[model samples]
Structure formats: structure tokens, C-alpha cells
Target: MNEQQNKKKWLRILGNIFFYGALLLLLFNPTAKGWFLRQLMEVGLFRPQIEQEAAMPKQPAVATAFAFRDATGTMRTTADLKGKVVFINFWATWCPPCIAEMPSLNDLYQQFRDDDRLVFLFINEDADVQKAKAFLQKKSYSLPLMTNTGQVPAQIFSGTLPTTLILDKDGNVVFRHEGLAKYNSASFVKQLKSLL
Candidate 1:
């Protein structure tokens, strides 16, 4: 083949390879998608901002009642976890943003796993608990996984995947973030430590 024709053929082959490679990555690799989203956040494509509530009331303005089952099939309630810094994250296995932020959330959980003052609840919205468990096990994430059993308060989760709420010791929602964020960031840890 002539030089120009050979070059054109190679370019077409490279383009096809690139297209298929990206398709496979999107189809099968959740971690790769997570990494892509993280890169976007790093480049300021989307900033995950935490809006801190200035002076949360002593009592939760909205109902704080929520029921969920733990990993061991034990039913737990938000009321059962009163007087603790409860970190409740609503997420689903299929959510790309949720998957992206999960690693950071897991890191944050590891840092405070021993602290009785703090409680981390990774509420999986997936219908199948076994599937959710498998996903976590596959990722080797140690975050506590829970499934909503009863009515979850609208104040806590308004049908938004990857929503996170930080309740103070008094059961008051101090920080409610509705997107992916770097939960393991130093400043975020400092803010959480201050609450504890």
C-alpha cells in the first residue's frame, strides 16, 4: 500500500481500538468510571461543595426517624443512634457518582471506625442486599452497609443518590450534602472531628 493509504488504515484501526476500549471500560469497570469522575472533580469540572448549616437547632426541625437493617440482619433506627455523630449516606450501586465517592467515604470510615462518638451508615438503595454486599466485598470497602426497611425521612433522603447527611450529637442535621465529595480530605476530617 502507498504511504498515505497505510497511514489512513492505521488511523482507522487506532480509532476503532480506542472506541472499543472506552466502551469496555464503561461497561465493565466501575472503578475506571469512578476514577474518571474523580479526575473531573480534580480539574474543577464539578466542585463538590459542602454547605454547612450555621447553628443547627438543638432538635431536628424535621423528623429524624429512619429504620434500616444492618449487615447482620439486625434492624436499627436513627433514634437508636441518638447522641452520636451519625454519618448517613444514601447511595445505589448503579450510581456512577456514588461509586466514585465511595473510596473516600471508606477511607473516612476507616479513620473513625473505632470512635464510638461517630456512626457511619452507608445506606444502600439497591433492592438486593446480597448484590450490594457483593459489590462492597469486591471493592474491599469496609464501610458499614445498611438497607432502608421503613420510611426514610424526606429530610434525610429525598430520593437523591449519593446524598450525605451529618447529624450532630443532638440528632440535628448539621451538614447535608447532595453530591459526590472527598470525604477523606483533611479539612473535612477536621470539621467532623470538631463535631465529635
Candidate 2:
């Protein structure tokens, strides 16, 4: 082959190698990082998320409700809280997935807060009033809130924490979450909007 043709062939081969190698790297490291960095994050930073969910509320938690306040000053009772979609999330201060997922839940609630057809009652499984209050204050959460304070048993929880329990308008538990869920996830919003 001519010298120029050979040189062109070499350039094309090198270009193909670079392109295919980059594609392979992307395929192996789906976390938008290098494969090794992704693996490091999974083992280091992301492990806490998994560990937190694992440590979250387990055992049964009762379905009873107590009076609580929403973002507004109005009093809210379980009975009064019914209708539309009721997402009763029972979480504690220490649950990793619970904390990770609350921001999403808060966003979801705010998006639908003005809608009269929904109630996102984030129930605290903690009996300690002061601690719960401090935690809420620190987070600056303003959603409708309540606490069991031992009126409910852990046995009522289906032995899982980080469960986002969705109730129908009738207050029946429709869906339960046992893991981290995108608070404003498309599927979650769609399900909630559908119920409303």
C-alpha cells in the first residue's frame, strides 16, 4: 500500500480504539465516574445508605393516629387527615434511608401541599418529644407531623423501617416502602396524583 494510505489506516485504527475504550469505560462505570471511583463510592459513601436502611424501623408499628399540626396552625387528626392520598411514613432520627428519603418526601408534599385532597403525615416512631422536636427544627421541616409516643407498637410496622406507607382516601394502607424511594420520583408522583 502507498505510504499515505498506510498512515491513514493507522489513524483510523487508533481513533476506533480510543472511541471503543471510552465506551467500554462508560459501560463499566455507570455512576458517571471512572470505574474505580464508582466502586470506591459504592463501598465507602454509598454503604452508609444501605446500612441505614438496614438499621431503620423494624418490627410492627400500630396504625393508630394522634392529633398533630401541619405546616399551617390547623389541628390535624387521623380521622380528619383522611381522604386523598395519605402517605404515612414512620421514621426515626437515626434511620439512614429515612433521612435520605425525607427531602424527597418534603418536596413531594410541598408540591401537593396546597391540594386539599392529600395528606403526607410523617409519623415519628420516636417517643421522645424533645428529640423529635429538635430533629424537626434542625431540618426545618414544615409538613403535617405526628408522633406515636409509644401508643403504637413496633410490631405494627411489618418489621421494616423506611417504609413509605401509602393509604387510599379511605385510610387503608395501599402501598408500603421498605427502602429508599425518590421523594419526587416520577412513579411516586404519578401514583399520588392518580389517587388524588
Candidate 3:
């Protein structure tokens, strides 16, 4: 074949390859519902939706400031707990999960309460002082009980009772558990012990 004719043929092949590749990319782009597009969608939006869903996210609120006063009117500022490992558990007087887990919670608190490097917060979610006080008296748990005064600190509860958050010494949330946790579950205990 003549050199000029051969050159033209090679050009046509390269042009076809480039054009087809561009068309494939545009056709399979996100919003096209194609497999590649679906992957892109999952990476761009769907994945986060699943991760940030109402379920327990890995990290809870650690850097945010939250305050609640003890029944005796003493103030507890979350900022003050920054250098310590902090566990904030949200409970309500009427919650069975909260009641059932009380003993274990107390045990955990007692073991770590005196440790200046660790702090535990038993935050009651909108539980009336009378009811909470009555229950605490019956349980004989000396841990401080602080009720939610209306503003949520981190939405850690997502408006539900019995959510728990664990913060590291640096004030970064390392664990978040939603719902009633078996206070002594191996996984939970392991995490707690690791913090200590």
C-alpha cells in the first residue's frame, strides 16, 4: 500500500478508538443507571447514606461541648473531661434497657470512677427528676444522674434513649453504640478496657 494511504488508515483506527472511548464514558456516566454509573453513585452518595444512617456511627460527639447539672445542682461541663476517657450513656427512667443495664453500668463506673484519667456520664434523656431520683434511690447506685434539659448535645441518641458514646483522652470519639447495649458484652468490654 502507498505510504499516504497507509497513514490515512492508521489515523482512522486511532480516531475510532478515541471516539468510542469518549462515548462509552459519557454513556456510562452517573445518572445513566449503568453499572459504572451505579458504582459512581454508590461511592459519591449511597455509601455515605449507609454509613451515616440512624444506626450507630463509629464516632460519636467528642469535640462538641455538652453540659448537665447533677441532681444536687452541681455543674458538669464536657469540656472539663477533654483529657480523660469519657463515656456518655443516655438513658431514661422508663427504659427497660436502661434499667437492665444499670448494674453493669454502675460496675463499670465504680471501677473507673476514681481514675482521674476516666470519666463516666449517666445522662438521663428527659426523665423527670422525681422519677429518676426515685429509681436511683431504689437501685442504690451512687453514680451522678444528669437529665437532658432539652437541648441535645450531639444527637448521639438520634432522639432515642440508651445510646452510648466513648471518647478517647484527646476528646475524639472512638466508639458509638445505639440502642441498649449489653453492658458486659465482650466487644463492649474490650473497647472499654482498651480505653482504660
Candidate 4:
């Protein structure tokens, strides 16, 4: 082949390799997926827009009964989190959207980790706790990780990955969002401050 033709062929091969490599990374690596999502957020995608309830009810319609075990194997429940702003996020390792939004969730967690009036629960829906822990540790996220030890409340998790529910101090569902969102947005922090 001529010199120019050989250069063109090599370029095409390198392009293909890069494309496939990125595809595999997005598919298999949770940290890569989270980084990609954060990039998208930088360009205005998945901007956090919290849907506030028109009238904050005294209690949630669905019972908030739930029990989950933390990384230290300590059992906890929403009932135990009464009188505090509880943020519950249901996610799984294989879920692309869940992985994508995790970094923003981590940022949100960092902002409130020191607050005694707020509690954040990152509930891993995957049955394998070790795999979930590995994912979090690999990403170096400090968010509180938990796995459901008992039946998850239907109101909290309706078989959806990346479902988030914010409960008020009285344990009423004040905001609920399904799918991916930028949890570190200013509006979201303002909403949480309002509750606080």
C-alpha cells in the first residue's frame, strides 16, 4: 500500500479501537459510567430539578416500613430515622443510570454528611453486598452504603433503579424523583435547607 493509504488504514483501526474500548468501559465499569454522566451534567444534562409537593402532608400515603443493614452490619430502618430529613436512593451495580448519577449523589452526601438533621441512605438493590461495596470503594465514594435486609417499602422502591425519595422531618415524602438527576445542584440544596 502507498504511504497515504497505509496512514488512513491505521487511523481507521485506531478509531475503531478507541470506540470499542469506550463502549466496553461504559458497559462494565461503574466509575467510568459515573464520570461520563458527570461530564454530561456539565453540559446541562440531568440538571437536578426537584418536584416539590404542593401541600406537604403530615404522613406519607405508603407506609415507610423498611429495614436495611449498613456496611458494618448494623440494622436500620426509616422508623429509626424519624424527625430527620431522610434521603433514600435505590440503585444497583448493573444499572447504567444508577452508576451515572452516583457521583452527584456522592457530592450531595458529602455536603450533608456532617449534618445531624439529615440522613442519607444509599441502598444497593443488588443481592451481593460485597460487589456493591467493591463498587463504592473503587469509586472512593464516602456515601453511606446499605443493603436491604428485609422487604423494601413499595412506596420507597417501585422496582426502579435510581429512584430517590426525600422524606421530611415528620417522615412524609416531600420529594420523589425517578431516573437520573444532578443531586448536587443549588436548587436541590436549597430544598433540603428548607426542610432543615
lDDT of 2: 0.60
Kindly give the number of clashing pairs for every candidate: 0, 11, 0, 0
Q: How would you encode candidate 1's per-residue C-alpha lDDT over 1-196 as one tens digit per residue? A: 8999999999999999999999899777877778888777665554433344535454463487688888898998888888888999999888888988888889889999999999999999998888889999999998888998859887778898789988877778888878787788776788888888
Q: Over the stretch 1-196, how does candidate 4's per-residue lDDT look in tens digits?
A: 8999999999999999999999999878876887787688778887754444525454563487588888798987888888898888999988878888888889999888999999998999888888888888998988788887758777677888889888877778877778888888888788778888
* Whole-model lDDT values for every prediction: 0.82, 0.60, 0.64, 0.82
Name the regions of candidate 3 deviating beyond 4 angstroms.
Answer: 1-63, 185-187
| All models, RMSD in angstroms | 2.8, 11.6, 17.9, 2.8
Q: TM-score of every model?
A: 0.84, 0.57, 0.62, 0.82
lDDT of 2 at 65: 43
User: In terms of TM-score, which candidate is strongest?
Assistant: 1
> What lDDT tens digits, residue by residue, belong to model 3 across residues 113-149?
7778777788886446777778788879877788765
Rank the models by lDDT, top first. 1, 4, 3, 2
**Positional deviation of 32 in candidate 1, in angstroms?**
3.8
